[model samples]
Target: MTSSLHLPRRRRGLNRRQALAALGAACALAPGAADATPEAARKLLGDLVKVAPKAGKVKIDVPEIAENGNAVPVTVTVDSPMSPTDYVRAIHIIADRNPQPGVASFMLGPDNGKAEVQLRMRMAESQNVIVVAELSDGTAWTATREVKVTVGGCST
Candidate 1:
């Protein structure tokens, strides 16, 4: 009797090792496996903001070097009066080089008390963190911060 590993070529099936290798190769050649680029991040920003975001009023607070990219602390603050007439309407966070650039978004109003948000974000690698704050006056402000990640967190 022929052993399973030595079956006739016409009836043979992929072994465990061959199957894993084929799967890995297929995944490597699959579309959309590449990480998000700066342009992708910019495109996402454009979709959220009608006009180019001005570089002011928005601030990003993050570490210059993150020991771990998993759950890295992030804070986005907008210098807004937080009044009904003049307040932050939204806050968007983008990771320029992450697998998926869009990190988080928050909708706010005068009732939120302050135009600040704090959260932890996973990063795939060292990249720029962008913050855009849309105000009630149909204007958007932005800020960027670069963080060096020693260990990536997105995959883990």
Candidate 2:
């Protein structure tokens, strides 16, 4: 007896060239797939002009214990007047355990009223989240927070 339900099937007809191309693409992404580590996080920080950013004047808000790994709330606030002369230039959020350490970055101008940013990010595992704020005066400040995750997000 044939059932009335129908299901989609994957196309598996691939020639040698197509198979090689697919294999090459998979190989190309293999390294990047496993590149997320503490060292990767450090590499991202090192790429910045100021790797050794001082810790101060910035507050990073993240849940101390996150049950869901996906869509974790993150907020970074800088203590600044946000005047034309003094304001936050950029804010970089880093996730130590994500597929890529560089989670997101927000660029702000003097016209922006406040030096604060709020967004959501993903966490792979329990790790420290770092926030770095670059000011118009060529100064960078950073803050770090450890978050515990019950389930993993990326590569899980």
Best by TM-score: 1
Error of 2 at 94 (Å): 0.5
lDDT of 2 by residue, 58-106 (tens): 9998899988888788888999999999999999888876767888888
What would the per-residue lDDT of candidate 1 be over residues 55-120, giving only the tens digit for each residue?
A: 999989899999999989998889998998999999999999876789999999999878999999
Q: lDDT for every model?
A: 0.86, 0.81
Candidate 1 TM-score over all chains jointly:
0.79
Weakest 10 consecutive residues of candidate 2 by summed lDDT:
1-10
Model 2 quality (TM-score):
0.76
Off by over 4 Å in 1: 1-31
Top-lDDT candidate index: 1
